[model samples]
Target chain A: MNPAARSADGSRRVLLMLLLPGLVALGVTFVLPLLWLFRASFASSAIGAFSGGDWTLSSYETVLTDPFYWLVAWNTLVLGFNVAVFTVILSYPIALFLARTESRWRGVLTALAVAPLLTSSVVRTYGWMVILGDQGVINSTLQALSLTDGVVRLTNNSFGATVALIEIFMPYAILAMLSGFGRLNTQLEEAAAMLGANRLKVFTRIILPLSLPGVLTAALLVFVLAISAFVTPRLMGGGRVFVLGTEVYNEATVTLNWPLAAALSVLLLVLFSSVIVIYQRALRALEA
Target chain B: MTIRTSISRRAAVASALAIGLSLLSPAAMAQDTSVTGTVNVIGFSGVFAENYEKFIIEPFEAKYPGIDVTYRPSKNSAETLALLTLQRGNPEIDVALIDVSVAIKANQEGLFAQLDPAKVPNIADAPDWARLDGDRAVAFSQDNLAILYNTDNVKEPPTSWNDLTDPKYKGKIAAKLGDTRGVILLPILTKLKGGDYKESIDPGMEMLKEIAPNVSTWEPAPDCYAVVQSGEVDLSICWNGRAQYLHDTQGGKIAVALPKEGSIGQTNTIGLVEGSKNKEAAELFVNYALSAEAQATFAEKSFYGPVNTKVELPDEVASRIYGSKEAQAAQMSLDWNFVADQYSPWIQRINREVIARY
Candidate 1:
């Protein structure tokens, strides 16, 4: 072979070697199970009929055609979007604080952000339950201070549960943004200032544009977490609210409809993957 | 120059430490499968884990020295069912100690390995009432749903399901929900309104709605005992075993009573997996699990009534469970199949109507 072709072959082999472990892991753990689940989704409820019981689209039809499933899907999307928006809003300021703060307090700031992530979701949500419940610490304090006449209806409310999720997932976005800010060079801002540009102008033109990557990363993380969050919504929302995660849970566990649940899971996976791909494309376009 | 180098070195060290921490977490958790020859049974919590291990696994492992047994406790039947479904084909579980509702569903789904009663003689000792279709499963223990109330909260514990909805106890009650269908309340609720459990949905739903506002929360876990123990709710719908356990551990704050109309009783069952490698061992284990000694141990520890009639429990244990003549006579048991079938719709409706509004 020619030298260039030999080098190309060598590079391909090296790439394959590098990618082998991840590919094998995914194939073993995820791909094969998903394939089985896909098959199961088409299978009939009749026993020993693993195959050839009419490969119908009935399961997918059930999920897509049903208003209940659609409602859950819409709720999941809304929850994801709200979480993403809130994470960006909350984490942007926190990221700015971490990036601009004195070095001594950086550890403390990071610790405060990371503390919630380190704990179990169930424990954190349960803590929220105690704080947000009727006759809870918050309500009791409010009452004593004459802020309200009675204990507030907070524990079982959707808005309260959403706030709890936002609080729980904020750290990831903030941390990612902080790292992004660290990588960002302050040269453009300094150069802008040298030209007598105002601080606001310098920031808007330089820092905001530079930090877009990190902000995107944070939003993506929040979206993924919010969409897949089962425990927080189940426990704190008290099953009064429904989402795709809970719907999948109810289908598989409560209703014993494996095919339907699997179909729903597949839909979720597809939606999540599509969103991620679109996000990356958008990020690339913005960068260009 | 030395000072600048030292500061840079300190920064390098900090970066290394942060990177190390981030990398270590996933690596630490990647040690996922270290299965070293053990039998794993996943199911709900209670005396089943302890009794099964003590009487069944330990003895079997004694006979077969190399075998190790692991018991995984699930919070509820639905969770157990989910876990089983997830672990299908490559089941991390060898056996599952599950409720009748879960077992029946599993049986229908071919999740369970059917047993030959001729192969498993201990199946005979299981109460006929506890058997499902005389085929796939056998009862190990009965977790009877009894009326448990804090004596201090009421002058007398209500003798019927009707009294629970009385205005006197408004906003001072709690109830079980989700997979815990309160099958025990079905018969009593139906009989109180002069109907059978199957035809009693309207009345039952009405009954639930009356108490819905009063119920502080629809506890989906057996840990509802802790709620009562904390004096958060004056009275609650609780299991006999839970009441017995809490009363024993924390003190006699809660008293368990079998209502005159009779509550629903549930029998927790054991069955062999359909494709078990060791059907002989599984049946052997089940036979021993249903033995009188095992039953007594389960009764004493879990406060659940034993299905084995041959087993004689201690007076206090017997009195606390559902095996007593009065307790047995009063129990208004319903068809578990009916509950399992209708449960999804009923819960969805309840969630939409009562729980969401309340």
Candidate 2:
């Protein structure tokens, strides 16, 4: 072989060596667990089938056939979509303000945006429970301000759970958009302005279009998270709201129906993966 | 695969990795051991575990100096069940403390060994209802479902299940959601309406629906007791042991009431693994756990109602043990298996048709 080719082979070998540890770690942690989960999804409890003998689709059948499961899936989708949209709508402007400003106030705003992410999900959910409870701060404040006659229904309802979820997950979208904003080329905006275009025109024509990738990425990230969220919905939704995550929990734990739970999880994984792939493909097409 | 196919697969894998990493911190893995070096026990995270550590664990560890004892605590049975499942083949956990219903479920799953009654002679002293159950599980402690109310706010707390459903207490009442205690309430409610607590639950659902709007909130844990103690909630359904603890700790502000309509109770049971590595050690531990001395110590330290009839309990504990010979004459325990089987469906149905209406 040529000396250059020989050197290239050495570099390739080094790169492979460097990547080995991560591959092993991922295999052990993610890939193996997912395979186990997939196998479990097909499994039947003691009643429906014998102890791990046949490859049956009864679990999937039950999940597909059940109206309640469908309701849970619908609720999960609706809640996830609402949370993603609300987080983006609320955080985009804040993220923009932080990126555009050079003052200490921008730092303060950024810190405020990310503060909730520092706390554990359980602790934060409990905090919202206190804040959004019927007799909690929100109701107490409303009552004191004479905004309502008595305590208004808040946290223990679907709307309250949505608001709490949005609050908890808004930082993800904000940080995504913030990184995109950080990488934005300011020269193009300056050129548009020098050409007599107003700030709004520059933002709409030059900035927003350019930042679409980041916005889409943020939405996808938040949506996936919101769909799988278990704690917030279980706590804030007052045990009334049936979402996919809670449904899986109920099936696996209470009913002791592992196959049904596994089937539900498989469905969720397929749906989630397909959405990400389709979205990413669309983004690639738009970029091209 | 083709180069393009490989590249795309890599991209997908990379993105998935990024997403997972960004979302969650890697959870610590439990150490896997081949040798039965020590006995690790799994249980609920509460006064029960605290009492176990004080009375049983401390004494057992001291007595068996050669062997070590470890207690792993979890908040929910779902998590505990998951943990137990993970330790399935290896059987790292020697003993597990779970609810009576879960013990039945675990027994069905072959998660527990057939406990030898001969080894644990103390079990013979337990009530016939607890022992006669064909399952391998043995009832260890009893918990009563009662209404805990603040004395200052409510002049006269409800004495029976009828008093609980009173329209006046609407919007002030709190109860658990999707918990064993919460499910137990259904059968109790059904029983109150001259209906079967076992077969049918429509009446109970109706009762819950009627009180749905009035439920200020449905708490998952006994956090309501702290709220009631602080005067945040005037009334809520609470466990008897937890209620007793709260009443004792917080003073005369809160009071516990077991209504005349009769309430349901749950027994926390113990079972052994089917293929336990340390069969001798596990049997010895279980036998000692149900002994008269252990039961008395548990009652004194943990405020749990001891199941060992041979043990002489303090007056406070005697008053709380619902199935005690004296207490059983007045109260009835709904069939536990019936409660366990129906609980999931009833809760799911209520979540859909009733609670969702709000």
lDDT top scorer: 2
lDDT of 2 by residue, B91-114 (tens): 877888788777766766678776
Best by TM-score: 2
- Determine which window of 10 residues in candidate 1 chain B has minimal summed lDDT: B27-36
Q: Which segments of model 2 are wrong by more than 4 Å?
A: A46-53, A102-112, A182-200, B1-40, B57-70, B74-90, B132-135, B220-222, B251-254, B300-303, B309-316, B321-328
Q: How well is each residue in B1-358 modelled by candidate 1, as lDDT tens digits?
A: 9999999999999999868855864432232232225556676676556656675566556555545666788877767766666566766666778888778887776777766777667667766766765557677777777667776776687766677788777656667555455444545565667766676566666676777776666642225676566565677787777677778777788777666665566768776666665555555556666776567777787777777878877676766776356655775554666766765566666655566566
How far off is each candidate at the interface, as Cα RMSD in Å?
3.8, 3.8
- Report the C-alpha lDDT of model 2 over A1-288, residue by residue, as the tens digit: 999999999999999999999999999999987887787777666333223555778888888898878878899999999999999989888887777777868878898888878898788888887888777888889998999996677866678779888988888889988887755678889999999999899989998987777788889999999999988888887666678888888777766677777788899998799888998899899989
Task: Please give the RMSD to the true structure for each candidate, in Å.
Answer: 14.4, 15.0
True contacts kept of each: 0.23, 0.38
Q: What's the lDDT for residue B157 in model 2?
A: 76
TM-score (chain B only), all candidates: 0.78, 0.80
